[model samples]
Target: MHDDRHAPRKGAIPTHALKAAQEIVVLKWRRTSFKRLDGSIDVLDDDWSLSIGGRSLARIYLLNGGPQDGRWAWFVQVFPEGTPGNGGVGVDDDGRAAREACESLLPPAIQQALADGRKSETN
Candidate 1:
């Protein structure tokens, strides 16, 4: 009796929030694996989201399942302001909205690094 939904089997990794923006969110999650009498397979699917002023900004879907060390994972899609083509709400007013969102999520060190990178690129 194996419950795939809530049960914690082997190779199951916990999901955690890593970064977020007004329209985007990044998350870190662990991969899961299962073994049966016939063979074994890996299951790696996770979801994340971002919010702004109590409103959801974006949704992130991740997939993490593969052979080898099992550390290989990938981000499947990043839905900003909900699903596209559905009249989704986004910060089209000014690019500042996006920049502010990014700043809020990123740490001071990372922000400085990004700023320096941008400066170097321009110079």
Candidate 2:
């Protein structure tokens, strides 16, 4: 919760943070066919990893069957070879929170690349 009386004037977590609304965050994630390290394409609706479009970005996953069902998971540099990743807590019933969580974990460069990719596609 943001303490309106003492929170920083320029930056603060909004009161609606708990709801995790799509409007609160501005990230565009398209469903792309995820290619495994073996180069096999697995295009499952529940598979949230959709190539963040950058150098060695993590592959974000939406948990469906595991104990952490409705949760999200990610790992850095999940391209050819990767690094350790992060996971989301609580349940994300609609995946909006997972998308927001994934966006938060993404590197700035990848996010920028995604923006740039959108621009080029429109041209």
Each prediction's Cα lDDT score?
Answer: 0.34, 0.46
Cα RMSD of all models vs. native, in order, equals 16.1, 12.4
Question: Highest lDDT: which candidate?
Answer: 2
Q: Which stretches of candidate 1 lie over 4 Å from their true place?
A: 1-92
Q: Write the per-residue lDDT of candidate 2 for residues 1-123, one digit (tens) a residue.
A: 656774433422232431232222333454547579999987777555544223223345577676877666554332111222332233455566655555555444445545565676678
Strongest candidate by TM-score: 2
At residue 20, what lDDT does model 1 achieve?
30
Worst 10 residues of 1 by lDDT: 14-23
Q: Estimate each model's TM-score.
A: 0.25, 0.40
Q: How close is candidate 1 to the true structure, as a TM-score?
A: 0.25
Quote the lDDT for 30 in model 2.
48
